[model samples]
Target: MPILSKETKAAILGAIHLKTESVDVPEWGDGVTILVSEMSGLARDAFYAKKEGGKVPISQSQADLLLATVVDETGALVLDESDVASLQAQGTAVLDRVVAVAVRLNGMQPAAVEDAVKNSAAAPSGDSGSSSASTSASQ
Candidate 1:
């Protein structure tokens, strides 16, 4: 489902030349820095953050680590370095599933909040007759 492949991301990230710009951090301090094409950066960010796979949410730190890896090999950070290295060395797979649940919840919360607002707004203001009329309309 991703528009960009791993190779593509690596290539794009590699293509970036960081030497041209000074190492100035953004005011927001997002904890990741790289010099790459805007589109490629966006694509890689989206992919690493699991945005391409719907209902998946990645932590900012994880996203930063992924981006750092995608950008500069030296900039990469892996919390479970030994485990990941072992898995990679053995060709094993590691799946983190919580992101999907978080994404789903993130998507659902807004809709639920909106529905609650609408229902509250639709309810008649202290009028029993209107409430009964609305209830009867459903039946």
Candidate 2:
């Protein structure tokens, strides 16, 4: 195959390629459904950065992933960093249900999330600066 031109490559990279799914959360209310979208490469990177070496808590990690993946009809994120506390206050089962879908949609194994939750319980709590370093490097 002939090599693609720069413009073609740019167009491909700029396209909206993430997949989305509707999640049912009966616990929240009767027939309550939410939309979740697959994470973009940058979003996924930021997610892993926060959980790098399991420094962050499991609840925090789940909230961060939810904030990144949960979207509106237009694929824009519905939650922001300010909503982390509120998201954490939500039911664990509900969070896990949605987070599981986001993880699978983003190509992450369920086992990894389980391990992170387990490891985070024993992991220390503090800014190790690893995530900051990653963010800096990416920038």
Candidate 3:
């Protein structure tokens, strides 16, 4: 299960958080339909296109496409190093914004949560302190 090193996992998660992270998509963000259509260029259209007429790749073409498309961001289909660097910069900016928000939120400790955990833990078992036992159940 642990095939990759820590650095590799970080790189993989960083790239994923970059692309899948939500950002304004220009004029297409008006509605779901429009956004879907606009992003369709980066969707499975190429994969399906190959499947349509049996033009599918048989080797490293698949690997090359995966790296090029995700790193290009604009779907320009060019795999130049500068193109990838530009896309990477955009993604990293988004990631930095998200990480900053998380840091700010973690600093803002909610009193209710603190009270629940602190009071409960300081109290005794079966004495209402057990109420602080964390649970995943939903209402």
State each model's CA lDDT, in order.
Answer: 0.36, 0.84, 0.37
Candidate 3, residues 12-67: lDDT per residue as tens digits? 55443222223343332464111001112344445335446545333333332333
Model 2: per-residue lDDT, tens digit, 63-130? Answer: 99999999999999999999999989999999999998998888688687678678879887986556
- lDDT value for candidate 1? 0.36
Q: Against the true structure, what is every candidate's RMSD?
A: 18.5, 11.2, 19.0
TM-scores for all predictions: 0.19, 0.69, 0.21
| lDDT tens digits, residue span 77-96, model 1 | 23333343332332111112
TM-score of 3: 0.21
Q: Give the TM-score comparing model 2 with the true structure, all chains together.
A: 0.69
* Model 3 steric clash total: 0
Candidates sorted on lDDT, descending: 2, 3, 1
TM-score for candidate 1, please give it: 0.19
- Flag regions of model 3 displaced more than 4 Å: 1-42, 55-57, 60-64, 72-139
Index of the highest-lDDT prediction: 2
Is candidate 1 or 3 superior in TM-score?
3
Clashing pairs in 3: none
